[model samples]
Target chain A: MKIHIYQIAITLISSLMIFKGFENYIKGKNGQTVLKLLVRIIVWGGMVLIALFPRFTNILASTIGMEGNINAIILTGFILVFLMIFKLLSAIERLEQSLSQVTRNETLKEIKKED
Target chain B: MTYFENSKIFIVIPAFNEETVIQGVIKEVQSAGYENIVVIDDGSSDNTQAKAAELIGKMAFRHKINRGKGGATKTGIEAAKLLGADIIVTIDGDGQHDPKDIAKIIAPILEKKCGVVLGTRLLNPKGMPLWKIFANHFGNFCTWFLFGLWVTDSQSGFRAYSKHAAELINTRADRYEYDSEVIREIHLHKLKFKEIPVAVRYTKYSMGKIHKQGFINGFKTLYKMIWGLIS
Candidate 1:
């Protein structure tokens, strides 16, 4: 069994990311939702698994009907990036709406106080 | 005496960093025979609130944070509702709208002709710039396409709403798109609306304001309106 240096580096980075995700959840920062934490953990866990088992990439590529492992990885990366972008955009829109509502309610409350 | 003389007309001025023109706008509205003025200062870093507050008989409410013009206008509407307003007239704090037109805008509502009355500058766009005329037409077209409601000046901030219309037309947009959203609300609620030709004052100061409607904001507003429909 030959272990590549790149595999070691990838596993190390992925492990650190997984740990950080848990740490953030524990700290209750960013209003982290359970579903968000689960998604983060699953993504990082999959990265760690792929780095530890290089042969799994071949299986994944074959299962996905891709010609090569690199192609499979690139496609998956693009999908993940786009999905994350969409999720972030939705979150931003929700936050903006909430902020506007809060500002409006506060302004109205002050007016009520004056009256 | 005018038809709306007996009605409690609340002039809602949604201001954002308009310290330079807040007081003058309030005075103009005051001189226009409207005393129940509600100035919603949308979290201006300047002295817009103080200037508006200095004017007697004007109720000034400041948002702790900058909520776009739509948000401020919504707050003004809600405050006016609480203050027992029979008719609410929203005017830009930048002083672009003629305060004298307040009477004309609210007449349709007082006459029971419509639930909502919009002041259109396109009919009498005398001093309006060529670019503004084009932009307003584009906005009107977009509002028609998106909201299925068309008016001469869909982007006009100077509008008068009867208490029923004001309470019924709840908007979700917090920016320029809110103007279009009001059109959607009018269509959805089947509220009778009238567009009256109103004079617009295009001054160097108003045109110079970076926050006023422009090319980029127009596209952003269009995108937001689409997004709102989808989401």
Candidate 2:
């Protein structure tokens, strides 16, 4: 089935948002503090509804672009994109830890002096 | 009452089944000379309530079971506010946080600089577990990128908040996410925040103690950051 650019984007973004939101909720993510777990659950539920309702997805697709096999493409993209983000986070964490050690040493020295 | 001779600072110690750890925490805070300390029980089944029973005039609130860390911390702040505390500082019941850092943590707020003080452990992620270092930096980067503000560490549980910031952050997430989610609101509200370099002992005892599905949950933290970015 051919799809529209808008539909493709809407479907992809919504799906990505839902997936990431659910992932955070399941993994005990932090932003859930504002609405509690309700917001994450609602986002996950919405994703399920979108996947089930082709018309809803098609409407979103219509806004994105004229397309074909957009859902499959989006699903693939979501997985790859998340993996890439994961890698990016890992690299950044490694670098930050390396930089903070000196400050941490000074912090310990100050704590001891206070004693 | 401006950090003068007779100033009062109430501490909110959130204890979750902390029979072993609560004692030292109370003693530690007392040693720091913070008089108006309050411990919120958060419905612990153990001797948590009993251990903290010695302090006179200290308000204690207990949840039936567990309302989560965020709920417990909120209860402490609200109770401290009611008790007329000039500043409220949060100390972890578990021995993971170094109590000596309290003064540094609260200095800015005591001086009326920043509304909130976050005890950041970002200065030395190298000596820690690889997984934790990875997780924390990713979360910190997302916070900095999205909010356009810099906080060296976002995941540390130890923190100090001015009475104003305490009240502002009283309504935090009901779980660990409360730590990150509060950062969002702090920015949204345009409240000033500072990250004080604090020491943390990351022993196996202090690990996140994830349940049966630990890996899956860590993945969810990553997903949460991505969702924050996309949204």
Instruction: Assess each prediction's global lDDT (C-alpha) against the native.
Output: 0.89, 0.66
Give one digit per residue, the lDDT tens place, for model 1 in B68-152. Answer: 9999999999999999999999999999998989889988899899999999999999999999999999999999998898799
For candidate 2 chain B, the 10 contiguous residues with the lowest summed lDDT are B206-215
Prediction 2 global C-alpha lDDT: 0.66
Q: List candidate 1 stretches off by more than 4 Å.
A: A1-80, A113-115, B1-3
Per-residue lDDT of candidate 2, residues A1-115 (tens digit)? 6665765666677767766766777787543554534554455455555555556656656666645547744863595577558647755644433333332233234223444
Residue B94 accuracy (lDDT) in model 2: 74
Per-residue lDDT over B100-164 for candidate 2, one digit per residue giving the tens place of the 0 to 100 score: 78888878887889988888877855456777677778777866775566577776777777767
Estimate the TM-score of every prediction.
0.78, 0.61
Among all windows of ten consecutive residues in candidate 2 chain A, which has the lowest summed lDDT? A102-111
Q: Write the per-residue lDDT of candidate 1 for residues A1-115, one digit (tens) a residue.
A: 7888988888888789788888998899976778878987788787777778867888999998988899877876887797678778778888998999888787777557777
Q: Is the docking of candidate 2 incorrect, acceptable, medium or high quality?
A: incorrect
State the lDDT at A102 in candidate 2: 31
